[model samples]
Target: MTEQVYACIDGSVSTRTVCDYAAWASQRLSTSLTLLHVLDKESYPVAADYSGNIGLGSQEQLLKQLAALDEERAKLAIQHGLHMLEAARERVKSDGVANAGCMQRHGDLVDCIVEQQGDMRVLVMGKQGAGETHPGRQVGTHLESVIRTLHRPILVSTGTFKAPERVLFAFDGSQTSRKGIERLVSSPLLTGLQIDILLVGADTVEHKEQVKWAANTLTAAGFNVPNTAIRAGEVDEVIQHYCQQEKMDLLVMGAYGHSRIRQFLVGSTTTSMITKSTIPLLILR
Candidate 1:
């Protein structure tokens, strides 16, 4: 079975940006694109908060009315989801993706992804969704959960989509980072784009050697790999500053570099960097 790129389309302002990025990826990788819209079951709940001193018949009537309202809301939700999916499919198709398709699922977004994990080569979604109170202010509520649950590479879109001409790879010699480097070399997603290998904080001899080895590996695979090591300031801060100063198109890194305890209590570098980034992030696990 051929792998397809699944682009999640919430009715957020960022939905179009996600579709643009998905189209770019689909064209580059020569893969089919699927625009997925998931109508969250939890979003529509029957209201039954009738604790007044009313008669039993009145209470029953209220319950029936509430159930009817819930049914109407559910129908509207499904219609909205279908409309969103159709719009996303047309947007991606107009953006140069020839084989774009759409799917509408009724459940949690993460559950839907789990059901379609086998054929998924990559997952694309907006960092923030329409349900968010503030736009582009924080990460989407489902973003972290989807990353933790799914093993495929995820592309988190932040702003308008531009074809990436240069990409920054954050390498720290961990198993996940090594896997990211290998993916970069083998995958057609980042092929033909200039790459920069960066190592932040505690630039020891071992760190330098690791950076050198990574650069050589990428160079041997016919990539324009430039290397840099920084031994100052916080890791996320340094990386964000460098990426902004250089105007990089994308930030690539491994997800969850530290232990689970630290990640749960104090947040990981992956989340921090993504929160501070203005460009899109291509995360590998």
Candidate 2:
């Protein structure tokens, strides 16, 4: 059976690019891609303005008109969202992916993305959407929340579709890192790609040992992942530096490893990577 990939879109300009990249990945891996659009119910306001010149009797009619307008506006949003996703699915179908689909729902976007992410090998999305995405200066917090909450690998499409000729895997000797290595080794999505298995903070004894084991496992599985290490200040910085130096097409790493939910939320390395990487980073949880 083919693996499943779920992607979330806000119908932005990057929506097509994100879907194309997802299609590329699905084709590469022979996975089914599900395109999802989530309309946050929170985007709609519940309260109404009652004060008007025609005071008592017309108030009921005015409220009804207001409700109708809101309903129409909401329906338009849903239709627009579906249009973009359907177009993406059509494109994927044209490219010979038989199992591509488009789904739209009304709820919390982050929560919906996480729920759809269940049982999916990868979750593909844009870096950020044009909305009330808080902390929206450089990198939006909504993307970060999705990355941190969903325990699936996330592929954030920053720009155009580029087949990942070279992939960089951050080897940190964590359980998450091991899972990433296993996915890289076993998944058809990554086959025939030149990989750079980088173990940052390999200055520690445990880190070196884990890297050695990981490298051997990868090699034995028929993947030629060249191993390298660089002592670093912050882990994310090290990853960025190495990825930049190698001109890597994609960076794959674990989202978090054995951390409490609170710590995961507060001190998330995953967020750092999503916010900082020059190229696209595929984060596995």
Candidate 3:
């Protein structure tokens, strides 16, 4: 069966961008796409006791007005959620992606979505939303934790909506990267995709052998691969330049799963790709 993709919708411009990308992936990977939007009320904390204990038992007019206003606010939020779901569903359908649907569930948004991550192959979400990122997260809220929590790949968007033409696959020969590359090789979604396989490290003889192992494997699998190896500069900087030069549309990378990875975000390479790339990124954990 084709893998399933879960994408979050927040009724922002970026959400539309994310939806388009997800629909494309769904069609490309031959997978199902779930458009999820959560009505979050529990995550955001509110003031409970303001300035001592304010009694409300005796106030007739004040209590009634407050209750009415609260209900109005809730209705408005629900209305917004409905409109967002409909618009997103239309976008997904227009993209020609099948097996797609809209969801307007409730609860802590991240928590609700995270609950569904177990069965999903990837989670696509925007870097920012509704004029701000999620609270207590990275520059793009929920991205860091989402990556950390899920074993699946999480694609952090650049807010750019376009079909991917070229992909930069960062190679380290790590086990995680091994699985990532294997997925690429086995999947038909990348049948004719152009990949710029980047091998970055010291220009030592041993590293060249590592690259050979990767190249030979990919060549055997029938991929049109162009390669580059740079022994200088940071990983992020090198990737940015390559993206500009090659006009890379997406970045394919592996997730961090080791302690050596802790010194850098979940995985230094994954974090670097998200922070630096001017294009969208697809991570495989």
Q: Which portions of model 3 show Cα errors greater than 4 Å? A: 1-3, 42-55, 133-138, 259-275
lDDT of 1 by residue, 111-166 (tens): 99889889999999898867876677677778878888887889999878899998
Q: Give the TM-score of candidate 2.
A: 0.85
Q: How large is the C-alpha RMSD of every model relative to the true structure?
A: 3.3, 3.9, 4.0
Per-model TM-score, in order, reads 0.90, 0.85, 0.85
User: What's the residue-level lDDT of 220 in candidate 3?
Assistant: 84
Model 2 agreement with the true structure over 1-285: per-residue lDDT tens digits: 445888777766567667777888887777688888787777743334444534567577777787678878887877777787778788667766767877888778788877765558788888767563532224656777786678777888875667788888777776666877888787777788777777755377787788888888888888877656646566667777888888899987665666222243336555666667656768676
Say which candidate scores most in lDDT.
1
RMSD (Cα, Å) of model 2: 3.9
Off by over 4 Å in 2: 1-3, 44-56, 94-99, 132-137, 202-205, 259-271
lDDT of 3 by residue, 198-230 (tens): 765667777677667777777789987777564
Which candidate number has the best TM-score? 1
- lDDT values for all models: 0.80, 0.72, 0.70
